[model samples]
Target: METININLTNGYSIKSLCADDFNIVKELCEKCSDYYLLIEGVLPSKKDVDEIFIDLPPNKSYEDKYVLGIFKYDELAGIVDIVRDFPDAGEWMLGLMLIKIDERGNGLGRNVHRALSEWASNLGAKSFRIGVVIDNHKAMKFWSNLGYKKIKEVDMEFTAKKHTVNVMRLQLDE
Candidate 1:
């Protein structure tokens, strides 16, 4: 699939994520999850990072997987992915949506969400789902602003700590 660039007011753009972005994605994930209850406490070793990276499917390879990067003047600022999975419903899940700390507060999250939603719609997704850690109020608020409503909760274990995460969903065709 071709990556469509989203022009920003500051002259940067949002582009589709590629395999070449693995290193940046790894770094961004590590740093962004510093305060995440699940990752911060569970992933206490470098091996954890490696394991997580290894588990990710190749970028844009799966028929229902799409990853995107937020860029500022050619610098990677953040990333987001949509994976269509079916456990009960044909759902598209948002994964690893992150913005570099310094590059945040410029409405990048909204832009990324818009881009991902468009991509999901093109994929014929019926609903969009995302899991947010209970402690991550900022993310909860952001997802809420994008019209996601809390639908379920799960007790997730990472490292040795337990976290209650809210699974939020948005009906796409509504």
Candidate 2:
């Protein structure tokens, strides 16, 4: 992956995270127990943290994935697992985006999304894709508010539980 600048306002910095930051990412997940509970019905495990860096869709490689950490003053505050050209060419897939529990409702998520959007646009992305668990209404609203429209809903198994996912997309400008 080439160097990409993510301009986050409010003293936040975004950078690609690596294995050395596993504990930091795990700690962030621990802080986001509510989200995991809502989606997986359990707190994050070591395997879950590992999946953050290893999991990939069919035909996608590690080279196509970017595990980005959102930080403030050197403290990891959030994470985003994004894949370039996933599902199709000219598209980007947002596998996950999580903000620390205390960081919610402060507009940090929106700022991160905006920065990522601009970055994607600069990369010549034609659109962006994301899948939100149907039960995660707050996330659904967030994506919808950002101009993502529902492309479809599919039943899928996640963490050994059946889930309905709302696959949404935002078409970028030419």
Identify the runs in model 1 with alpha carbons over 4 angstroms from their true place.
1-9, 36-38, 42-61, 88-90
- Clash counts for the predictions, in order: 1, 0
Residue pairs clashing in model 1 are 42-159
Task: State the lDDT of candidate 1 residue by residue for 1-174, as single tens digits.
Answer: 556666765766777766666777677766666544344574324564344333443443355556667788877787766667633346777766778788777787787677667766776778888888878878888889889999999998766677899999988877
* Off by more than 4 A, model 2: 3-5
Which one wins on TM-score? 2
lDDT assessment of candidate 1: 0.70
TM-score of each: 0.78, 0.95
- Relative to the true structure, candidate 2 has a C-alpha RMSD (angstroms) of 1.3
